[model samples]
Target: MRLLILGTGGMANQHAKHFAAIDGVTLVGGVDVDPKRVEAFNTAHNIPNAFPSLDAALAWGEFDAIANVTPDAIHHPTSMAAIAAGKHVFCEKPLATDYAKAMEMTEAAEKAGVVNMVNLTYRNVAQLQRARQIVQSGEIGKVKHVEASYLQSWLVSKAWGDWRTESQWLWRLSKKHGSNGTLGDIGIHILDFAVYGAGSDIDHVFCRLKTFDKAPGNKIGEYDLDANDSFAMTLELENGALGVVHATRWATGHFNELRLRVYGEKGGVEVQHRHDWSKLLVCSGEDAETGTWKEVAVEPVETNYQRFAKAVAQGKTMEPSFRHAANIQKVLDTAVVTEQDRHEHTV
Candidate 1:
């Protein structure tokens, strides 16, 4: 398979590495508005073609798939163009910033009969997969409650201002780019994992969002700063499962700390991120009468990207489809809507 990557950001570089290492795949080229980024990626990866714009890359027309790691705002348009050009797409999450655009892209892919995948990489984590297996095996019984949080200390310190001090990364703080900051960026991963492991759908949500520390002088280009630095929500799921999700960039001492705890009728499961490894801890009620907790063994599994590639090659469907991704997007949309409504009422 020939793959063309759009965007030379960190995520795009990661994708390039994965695709390059995998057999039966070739990294055709990459495109980025930043000439330096494009040149750097081409030089580092030994890619023969480096296009200044996505249009130029698209013009190549020799790729079987397009890996879109562009900003949240360009996800829809870029994916649509790739799908229109008869190429499969692997788009980075939250799919799209808005539900309508996401749905449109999904519909387009479906109508065109092309394979569309979203890079919700957390779903590929070994511990999370083990949790899913335990839940599926009735080891956890009926899932009742879940709590998930993805926290970072990036914006907690003034040093993070370096990225925002430039106009390059400023689009992240803009609402026009879609779904406001870290909520869409990292929160969606936890939300998707929660829904996936619990095997339930969210019905309604109550949310609270805030911008605790605003660095006014930190401007990234022409983008305006109208995004939240932190967002928290309580979700009510379809199966009477209650969930709490928190995502924040302003949390101190927590760098990429993602964790999830699920409680069920018969047992509970916990997954924590520690440095480069994820640890899974499972507990079950001892007996009907005693009602005591006991540790259960959970064997580790590898990541999920290889599974996606396998599924694509074998012509099979992955469990969390773009359809499933769309569900998460709806919950995210509703949470934002609810937060805004409450804010309006308070005003």
Candidate 2:
């Protein structure tokens, strides 16, 4: 799998590292809006080529697939371009900031017969995979309710400037950049994992979004800090399961934490990110006194990149396909609308 990576940010570097590590994959080049960043990415990753734009890369780079690690707003355009050129795409999540645009990309990829996958990173966790298997095996009986959250303290005043200043995060907090703030950023992952674990799609949502910390004194240069810093939503799953999701960048103590708890008629499961990738707990049986939650050891599995490479080499459809991402997009879209409607009703 020869690949062109379409971003020069942190995630792009991770992609390059993993792709380079894969036995049958090659990181051909990278593209970025900034030539300097592109140069740095190429140099850092030992990639042979770097281009200032996708057009330039398409014209000169040798690759059969694109790693669309670009920002949320650019995901749609970059992916559509790659699909049009008959290249498979491994895109960062939310598919697109806009649901319709996401649908278009998925439809286009399907018509082009190109492999499409989203980076729902948590699904690659071995414990989460085990949770899915346990749930599907009916050991948990019927899934009844779920609670999921992704928390971060990165936006706290002390941590905000550790990497980049508050000004740098403004783009993520601005609508012009096509970020869904904390909701579309981390919330989508919870939604994807919740659905993956339950083997169901979300059918309805009632959402609320909050911007606790805004850029001081009305503006941070030209960009306004209007995007959500936190979001909470209630969901109804197609399989008749109820769930609540919360995501925040304002949590004071959390560095990066994602936790999910699913309860069923007979048992319950919990997958949490603590010291390790996943800490899983499960309890089964009808008697409360006899059933006690016990830690379940998670076995190792292939990394997401390895699975992607295998799918490419064998010409198999990747899990969490573009269509699956489209479903997530629908959930996000519904959350936005539900929040708006809730606000209007209150007003």
Candidate 3:
């Protein structure tokens, strides 16, 4: 499978590295508004072609798929274009800025009969995959409760570099720069972590968002620093589980982490993805009677990059498909409204 990478930002490097490592895939080209970035990305990844726009690339039409690593706002137009042109897409998360646009992209991909997948990132965690399997196998009885969080200390530490001066990090703090704050940034991730680990979908939400003062007068030059720094959502899963999903850049001690705890009548399970490793734990059967949680070993699994390549090769869509992402976006969109109206919103 020949692949093109759209938006040669930081995330593009991961996409390029993983896809290029796949057995049957080749990194054909890259596109970015900044030609220098595109040139650098091509050189770093050893991609042969670089284009200023997807239109130019489409005209050339040499690659079979595109890795849509564009910003959240740009996802709709670029992905719609790719789908319209009959190219498979593996997009970065949030799918789009909102559900309506996400649904449009999802429908377009479905109609085009293309392999469409979103990089929910955490889906690559083997522990998450195994926890979902355990949930499905009914080892946990029925999931009755869940707690999920995505935490980062970038606002409190330089572990991710200074957001004070970096465009990549600053843009995420400014709504004018197309950031929905933490909710838009990693909301989908923790949401997917909880729902997928519990083997259910979100059915309702009551959300609250907070933007702490990060700068003098709340202005860091062009960056507004107004995009929410933190968000909390209380959710009702389709299978009747009640849960809370939250994320924040202000989490002081955490560099970056995603954790989920799922509880059922028979037992409970915990899945965690820290910076470099993942683990799954369970307290079920006889152990559940005594509140003893034991670690369950999980083998490494194929990443979303590999899965997208496989789906493209087989001409079949997989989990976290465009439709599934759109569904998650529906919950996120409602979270925004729920925050404003100060009430629960059904998804």
The local distance difference test score of each candidate is 0.76, 0.82, 0.92
Best by lDDT: 3
Q: Candidate 2: deviation at residue 124, Å? A: 2.0
Model 2, residue 79: C-alpha shift (Å): 0.9
Better of 2 and 3 by TM-score: 3
Q: Could you estimate the TM-score for every candidate?
A: 0.88, 0.93, 0.98
Candidate 3: residue 38 lDDT (0-100): 97
lDDT for model 3 comes to 0.92
The candidate, 1 or 2, that scores higher on lDDT is: 2
Residue 277 in model 1: lDDT: 74
lDDT of 1 by residue, 164-209 (tens): 5655446667776454777777778878878776767787788888
- Given candidate 2, what's the lDDT at residue 88? 87
Report how far residue 185 has shifted in candidate 3, in Å. Answer: 0.3
Candidate 1 residue 320 C-alpha distance from true site, Å: 3.7
Please give, for residues 52-76, the per-residue lDDT of candidate 3 as tens digits.
9999999999999999999888999
Q: After superposition, how far is residue 84 of candidate 1 from its true place, in Å?
A: 1.3
